[model samples]
Target: MMAGSGRDESGAGGVDDAVRELLLLMPRMVGRVKRIPVPEALQSQSLAPRHLSLLSCLLFDGPMSVNELAARLEVAPTTVSLMVADLSAKGILDRRADPADRRRRIVAIVPERHDAIAAWLAPGAAAWRRVLTPLAPAQRRLFVDTLRAYEAAVAEERREE
Candidate 1:
């Protein structure tokens, strides 16, 4: 049956059409994002894709403690600590004792590395901003929720396999 013809034995083609389009579009989108080159300054950092989320959280929200970051990133505190330690060792991040809470350390991108990290991350952020700009608050929320659901569904499927 034609996917987008809006008619089929299933009563409607909308869902199937959307799925077909996304299945085709996702790989192309991933490939293009992958092609975005790592900036020269960060080339030797050996950063992984997971590092992007950590960096984005810091860049947008300012310095935060490992527990705060772990909460935001939905990862274990130990996981965030390990990443922070690795980045700190690479000179990409700095950790300082919080004045209000000396026992807690705040993690931030090194001042010298901020521009490079921003430059590397700017394109993706800008693209998302542009895409989401026209969406109403509800629509944007729905879009984000949909992506989260898809992620959970994929993880569940993978676990079952």
Candidate 2:
């Protein structure tokens, strides 16, 4: 297996190929994402890239406290708090006292805006789905499983640092 050609089969023969393909493709994908126009609704909101990152974090991880968000983003809690405050002012996010801990506030994306964000992301999702559409059912299952395992490995590498 040629290491650079991405033909290596780490486990499932095509798993390494897929992983390498994705690794190579990631930067271009990110570049495309960075170019996604800020929708009219968000344009007047004074949102920054970091704010979008925060929104993505909340969208995927569910509501979390300021400290948790800070830890996840590797920033200060005060930073997350300020960003949350700004987004809340724009009606893009909601903040409420945590049910389990009144002293803590749980921040979340407004349900109404979730679809807008999803729309912004829809093209990329569609592109991947299109790529996967022709594969056999079992292969699609393997792809998902392989993707999850790859994500875990990457996350573990980050943790070790």
Give the number of the best model, judged by TM-score.
1
TM-score of decoy 1: 0.92
- The window of 10 residues in a row where model 1 has the poorest summed lDDT is 3-12
lDDT of 1 by residue, 22-124 (tens): 9999999999888889999999999999999999999999999999999999999999999999999999999999999899899999999999999999999
lDDT of each: 0.93, 0.82
Candidate 2 residue pairs in backbone clash: none
- Give candidates' CA RMSD values in order: 3.3, 6.1
lDDT by residue for model 2 over 67-135, one digit each (tens)? 999998878999999999988988999999999989989998898888787676677668878999999
Indicate the residue-level lDDT of 130 in model 2: 96
Q: Which ten residues in a row have the lowest lDDT in candidate 2?
A: 4-13
Clash totals in order? 0, 0
Best by lDDT: 1
